[model samples]
Target: MTGTHPVGTRAPGPAGQWLRNLTTPPRGAGEPPVRLLCFPHAAGGASAFRPWRGLLPPECDLWAVQYPGHEDRVGEPPATDLTRTARQAAIAAQWLADRPYLVFGHSMGALLAYETCRRLDHLGVTVPDRLFVSGSPPPHRVAAAPADTDSVPHRMHGYEHRTGTETGAGPDNEQHDEQYDDLAAKTLSADLRMLAGYRPGPAWRVPWPVTVIRAAQDPDLDAAAAAAWQDYAVDDVTLATVSGDHFVCFTRPHDTVRLITGAVRR
Candidate 1:
């Protein structure tokens, strides 16, 4: 297990008060160029994206969304509703958007990321320059698209938010396998319920360029479903197939990092 990489401090809100509520900060090397706001998948948390921190370039900061009731926020109660969860994420994105930023979402996160982008536009806030969708179909096809219950091994590490760091990795995770499985089982079940209930009402569209990142060996990805994403984009839709399974973002993260940096800096 790779150890820890030092993280930046949590800055106060634009008004000077610490963001105790939803006013969160980016977690990466230094000040942002264009931040990469990452949202996790079903039964996933901020820790799932921790591997990308070291793989990311210094110019862009990463804010891996710690969904309510997942990992460090586990005590707050899980969000099984799609729209409400996306609304909360949009609020966080709004607070953290001090400059140009890109959005990356994998699996369930792709849906949340798209919804957040939509909400941002509705709020008159600046939407992401580009939206990177990884291993997930567009909103319209979600009902028919399948769910991946075994992505990234249910990251067992605790979500360390002390100054916005993702630490706590060791062999102990194996020790708590049974316990972790229990928690993961519950969370995954709730997420499946949420996914089963999602309805992407009429008028949902992604006006920005969309890059669909597909995992080479992902059995859950339906080729036609991946191609269907093009229908929702007004700008352009590009498919990128890389290594690993449905959880390619976490399994082979360098592929994702390279794609994100190329997009954000280009």
Candidate 2:
């Protein structure tokens, strides 16, 4: 109930239905059941992947999993635990039970997709056809403190990457009466709180081929961290470099799309 929903779960209210539908195949039948589920970093929403639809092959369906707290879920409370986030993704993966699919996540979203696949394995469910991780280290290599969410302002710190670009750590003019500074702090704190509390297990691993996309300009996504992805995949593994900082996927839409589409085609 707290994280992303599986494909067929009874839709929630207007917002819930929107989230659910986002995970469904957009085109009636042109797109095949071979889907690509995308998870955004902290403070990111499903809409972050709107540009990806045009980049993939017709055999690939696109679904963007919306984590609570951004976009339509703006007024709703954000998730505080990685476990909860993973569970939500697992639930949504069920809709693709009969179809072959892959998962693509960026930064915090990368970790979320990895853990969700692990949870599916535990449940004897079908793992993703492939795993695409961008700008994140393997779960086994992470050794950070649990996110701190006790206060409104402290939570956003968990989402800060080495590059300092936070998708959700901005001013909230509508809610905080133009107290932009305080609003930014609160938004950042929430994202940080969610990140700090996430602790991945050593046993978690993906049985499918895994691809890692690194931002050439992102300080957090160095060669060493990108190489660490080799330990997580059970099948094949590859690492590709792209332009821009941590937010390059958003900025360099065409190149990112080409890379993603090319990967799926293979």
What TM-score would each prediction reach against the true structure? 0.80, 0.75
TM-score of 1: 0.80
Model 2 residue 120 lDDT?
Answer: 81
Name the lDDT value of residue 182 in candidate 1: 63
Q: Clash number for model 2?
A: 15
- What candidate 1 gets wrong by more than 4 Å, as runs, is 1-32, 145-174
Best by TM-score: 1
Number of the top-ranking candidate, with lDDT as the measure: 1
Determine the C-alpha RMSD for candidate 1 after optimal superposition of all C-alphas: 5.8
